[model samples]
Target chain A: MNPGELVPAMSGRAWRVPPRSLVEVIDVEGSQTGDVFAVPTDDLEDGLSNGRTFDYGESIRLTTGSVLYSRRSRPLLTIVEDEVGTHDFLWAPCSQEMYEIGYGVTEPHPNCLDNLTASLGGFGVPAATVTIAFNVFMNVAVGQDGGLAILPPATAAGQSVTFRTERELLVAVTACAATTANGGAAKPLRVRITEGAGSPTQGRA
Target chain B: MNPGELVPAMSGRAWRVPPRSLVEVIDVEGSQTGDVFAVPTDDLEDGLSNGRTFDYGESIRLTTGSVLYSRRSRPLLTIVEDEVGTHDFLWAPCSQEMYEIGYGVTEPHPNCLDNLTASLGGFGVPAATVTIAFNVFMNVAVGQDGGLAILPPATAAGQSVTFRTERELLVAVTACAATTANGGAAKPLRVRITEGAGSPTQGRA
Candidate 1:
């Protein structure tokens, strides 16, 4: 099914992407972090693993042409078109506990974990299946001394990154919980899915 | 076709592996490094990339259940079994130029690149397809300060790591030019391929 929806700032949405479909994530308002997570529609255990993706990609910085791998080390999606060159490969999805610990906030705090789980729940994906996610449009840098710093996004409004799904997938995305965690107003992000040129039953059939 | 062969130290061998096959690499001699490389049988430009594997795996160290990804971020192979838990993911295959720069050695020094290219050439694969490889049985450690140190192999003779091919692959292996690169006698390594549980034509066909 094709979907074009706006993940309002501090919120998320989940979609079922068929094989060989293209999922485009757009930074609608710019400078807003969009956390993207995916799992195979049939196997939650074989979902996207940021650690494995990083280990396989051999870099924490992703660009156009980078492949996002699943926990099983199979290609789940490929970044075919990238409008924003910088995206974060480090850092886990910010959870409510992290918000409480880092920002002294209580429940009802907007967090990625909660948003992702809520969105994915509609697809029968369990909460525990949500692990590390890609922080699109987020600019986190590593220093010469291995120190990591979170900086404002370098992407401008309307910039986007398009990923071609290599497998049938359940994808969830959040506009980020900066309203509580980073103390900034959350901005909206857009997602568009289209049919890819590759055959739907090309691989893993 | 399933084949078993020995790659002598200071030498290399290449094989064409059908999809859904397993390649078992045995460290026949203890403390010897075995360099392993692979490319899609049809495309040399899509050879294995260690950087992408590490980035996707999100770890520098690999064990059973880890995937070996190609430069295009697709799964070429998966580690199905590991007899020796330790494997080197930090350093690229040693080359003749590396020998000259690091050890003051001149030409004729056995190196992984030459061996891999020579082996792959037998199958019509060009020299340019010899990309980064996994230095199996080699021990490299990351220090607290992010420094990398190549140490002697922690694996004993007869230990092995088995990888299952996810796609049609052309695999090359070298017994490592240890004589000049590591100042040690190079020993023989064994490569054995067998059919995997997954159907041979499950993906590409």
Candidate 2:
């Protein structure tokens, strides 16, 4: 993805947190690093099965006016606008455990869960209220012999995706799982939010 | 989410389990969920983040075909389809340590890490293989007290999210930490996977 410009959001609501919510991904460079998965707001029983994940190659590089769906086969949300490198739909996020296991506990790097928890807190969510999550960009492919294959991202910088929240939601996100050993050690990526880029309100701001 | 219709996967990657690597999530009623979050695939250091957080009224929900962006502001992936309810993007996945804290050493229930590890195992990835994640349909909001306020999910029946592997990737997901005693316990939900539902073409049977 590339750092082109900020895209606008689709439609927003006032339902508690507004029945629906949307997030715009700006890659800043043209690159696909991982995948993304999602579920519904009310139902929490189905942990991993709640989402409908996807890869970038499957569709048009996200841009202003793209619509994304969920796993249960419903119109989860819609992308209002986009800029920069395309976003990925198949990657997952990173976590503290991952750091401990991969980088070793001795490493002082913050984990995915930490960033998420902090982000949640920043969003008015409490520190202890963090819940489990679905990984996004990080790719861990399975081999024929039932093995994990950690691979590079398929997306670039400066891409984006937008959607409308179907209901009130509390969302959190992180950059790539790449680190010093990987290639993302330089700095974290940049993300932004806008209002109404799709539907009748495309590119409000 | 309601079990809309049964679309068996064209391949076993959706639900095949010689103990194939697959994750399941059941959507209870009355919540919203997100379907996708994209990030870097190899950089285990920077899991999904764009350096921004939301306020009390702001949120990101993942529905079918939805995309989750990074701090860099890019679309990592797109939500293809879903079956569960709406999803939360702010909530972090649970870990075994959480089990000890919540369950008091009674043996951790199926947590996010557990399910993810299982999913990785299907790909021959060891338990130590770590990657970033995008928590599908989790709810972690900012609170009035300037703290995290992870409210119960607003997901309903028959809602789900699906993703297509952009690049051959190995991803993992967990149901959620809000299950059973959290909120779904009042009405425990069940998640099911067919080809293309959660797992990949090489796994689901």
Candidate 3:
């Protein structure tokens, strides 16, 4: 309705979106990747399931028209618009332990898991439950033999992808803090919510 | 060891395997699927990582010569033998919430998450720490666009896959309870560990 929110670089933010509303994640500054997570308003315990979405939706590269599913297979959000098509759903959210083990970083490093857990703290969600996150603008290339290559985002400045909420949902977006998918650097992201912006769905339930 | 242990249909078992020891998972009956989990005996806090393995190993369909990495990127185990080459490392461990939400099954259902949690209870590891596990004899085919297809196990009766421990590790095996990957049924699995087995590594860090 008013000014869009900005997900500061290396941080995260969470809020609710009503049914039929449109939500957009903008790559505010080029090549800055982020992670998106959704949990139904009525069921904060249940969250997004990349496995279920891939199984039911038929692909991991979710673009326009792809329906994101809750762990229960309930439709939560549908991708309605796409300015960039390559998003990663395969990798798990990065955490503090990952930095310690992978890079021997002993200092406190901001990670998606902590950012998400803290962002969802208002809902009393714990860290472990924050297991999976749909990586927005994160490029993961799957090879013929199921090999995965974590490439940099193909997104550029001002590019954004939009989604329509199938039901009232609590969503969190993070400007991914890991150096893996953000071209070795982290940056800011933008989120805009347009109330009652999309038409109701047609056809079977 | 003398007799191999049997993970009853819908249950799990845990044990420690010494370095270079050969561990085998047998599909006791044709079409049975299983889940494999490992934690360093020293650190029960950390476990396996599908994301890290897929990144370092460069493939999800791990077979002979594939080294499984821990969450911190430490090499824990290597696949020295693979009777069934097609396996899934994509899906998260099935949980009770999954059955209730996805299938509306109200009855108490055995799941990989619970089975793993209970099995690792002996080591004082909690449920939340049992985050990721590798699905053995489980078929998850990835489409060209990263879509996933859960298919029946191609493993025949008595067919098995073997792994060599890179270090002393606490390994757990479970007879998968979910039907999505087992063709709508669950069955028993077999685990056998050979002590003081296999030759040392040739060249690896």
| Native contacts present in each candidate (fraction) | 0.00, 0.00, 0.49
> Which regions of candidate 1 are displaced past 4 Å?
A1-3, A179-183, A197-205, B1-205
Worst 10 residues of 3 chain A by lDDT: A196-205
Comparison by TM-score, 1 against 2, better one: 1
Across B61-103, the per-residue lDDT of candidate 1 in tens digits comes to 6787778776555689888888987776545566675566556
Instruction: State the weakest 10-residue window (summed lDDT) of model 3 chain B.
Output: B196-205
lDDT of 3 at B103: 73
- The digit string of per-residue lDDT tens for model 3 on B1-205 reads 4568989999999997888888889998878888899888877656776766765666677888888877556778888888888777777677786778667899999998888888888877655556568889988777785667778889899999988888888899999998768877889999999976866762232
Q: What is candidate 3's lDDT per residue for A1-205, written digit by digit as tens?
A: 4568999988999987889888899998788888888888786656777655764666677888888887556788888888999887767677786778666899999988788888888776654456578888888888887767878899989999988889988888999998767887888999999878866662122
CA shift of B189, model 3, Å? 1.4
Those runs of model 2 whose alpha carbons end farther than 4 Å from true positions after fitting are A1-22, A29-92, A123-146, A180-186, A200-205, B1-205
lDDT of 1 at B24: 89
Candidate achieving the largest lDDT: 3
Residue A113 in candidate 2, Cα distance off native in Å: 0.9
DockQ of predicted model 3: 0.38
Q: Worst ten-residue run, lDDT, model 1 chain A?
A: A196-205
Count of residue pairs whose backbone atoms collide, per candidate: 27, 284, 2
DockQ of 1: 0.03
